[model samples]
Target: MTDLSKRRLKTWIRLLGVTRGAENHLRDYLRRAHGTTLPRFDVMAALWRRRDGVTMSELSRLLLVSNGNATAVVDRLEADGLVRREAEDGDRRRIRVRLTPEGLEAFEIMALGHEAEVDAILSRLSETDLEALRDILSRAGRPE
Candidate 1:
């Protein structure tokens, strides 16, 4: 392989390793500290962002998860009184899920800890390093 090709392959591996490591750490921290799974937190985060609520299909699409997967999480959240599912006005078959007031409060608490955890995890990187890495990733993600 050409030198450029070889270097690109190594870079991809390093990127994947870093991504997986960070994800695993976050998952573990959430489970241990919050008594919640990453998927549950993700669902809450999505609902928190859309105060007006979102359809089940929209939630699935936003999370890039299957309908069944999103439904299961929503079901649990509803059971815990963290979220509510209301039938759409014009469409009986459609249900919009949203965080309840209690859910919003709960998520706010979790969000604070979540931010602190992330900051601690990435604390090794200086501000300049973070900016540089963010710039590189932003450029890499953009379509040519």
Candidate 2:
């Protein structure tokens, strides 16, 4: 492999390792601190970030999960009173999901704990490094 190929491969390896570690840390923290699983927290976090309700398709895309999986997760959230589903008056087939007030409160609590955990994990990195990491990952959202 060329030097550039080797560098890219090494970067991938580092990224995968770091991602797995971070995922585990977050999962363990959420479970112990909030009694929630990572997937449940992810769905709530996505909705918490959006003040306006999102469609099922949009949530599925944002979460990178299948539509059926999104539907099932949303169902559980709704049953827990953390989320509500509303049908569009003009389009009965369209459903929108929004976080309930209680959901917002719960998310805020979880988010505070999550941020603290992130800070502890990322304490070795300077603010500039964090910004660079954010910029690099933001590129993943770009279309091909």
Candidate 3:
């Protein structure tokens, strides 16, 4: 009921709207330009960062997704020859998933376009505005 409470509520709604809008735009761009879903791109991006590969558990943890979800994506990527799952040397029950050479090349191509798409989407924000927004968000996201 207080003025401060109303202002905070409005700010929260605006923030959510902006975040969803950006996400939707990126999703559309990826689907239209690359014929890929956001989740697939995210999995590839994570694998690209870790050339040595990661365990299925680790991949799920890294992406904050469920093991089954990560496994499904990995399964598809492996089928496409973009990734390989190898049994761990010491642990037969455990497996590590890594991007294949072809996967790396494919991800590189996608990464370039992804960067450009993001740039285009945020083109309206000036450098100064971006820096300011980043600072504000960083502070807000941190625990008090």
Candidate 4:
């Protein structure tokens, strides 16, 4: 490989490492502090974003996870009365998932902690450092 190619590969590896490390920390934080798995939290977050609710397939797509994985998490949430599944008027196969009042309350609490935890984790970076990182990520095709 050319010298430039080798440097690019190393940069990619470092970026992946940082991303995974941050994700791992979040996973652990969610599990230990909120008594929730990352998958469960993600499902709640997506639903929270779309208050009207989303079809099962849409939920899976939003989370970028397989239907089976999303189903497992949704099943658990349903059992806990955190989510309710409703069949679409004209389509039995398309079920909409919505957060219950209790679920909303729970997610709100978890979200507060999650936000604070993230802020703490990223607090290591100065404002300038954060701006630089965002610029680099934007240039690398990351959405704003």
* Cα-lDDT of candidate 3: 0.92
Clash pairs (backbone) in predicted model 4: none
TM-score of each: 0.93, 0.87, 0.93, 0.92
Provide the lDDT at 29 for model 4: 93
TM-score of the candidate numbered 3? 0.93
lDDT of 2 at 115: 94
For residues 1-144, write the lDDT of model 1, one tens digit per residue.
999889988998999998899889989988888898889999999999999999999999999999999999999999999999998996879999999999999899888989998998899999999999989998885555
Q: Which of candidates 2 and 4 is the stronger one according to lDDT?
A: 4
User: How accurate locally, in lDDT, is each candidate?
Assistant: 0.93, 0.90, 0.92, 0.93
lDDT per residue as tens, model 3, 1-144: 999879978998999998899889889988998888888899999999999999999999999999999999999999999999999997879999999999999889989998998898789999999999999988885555
For candidate 4, what is the lDDT? 0.93
Candidate 4 residue 76 Cα shift, in angstroms, is 0.6
Of candidates 2 and 1, the better by TM-score: 1
**Residues 12-129, model 4: lDDT tens digits:** 9998998898889999999999889989999999999999999989998999999999999999999999999998896878899999999999999999999998898799999999
Question: What is the C-alpha local distance difference test score of candidate 1?
Answer: 0.93
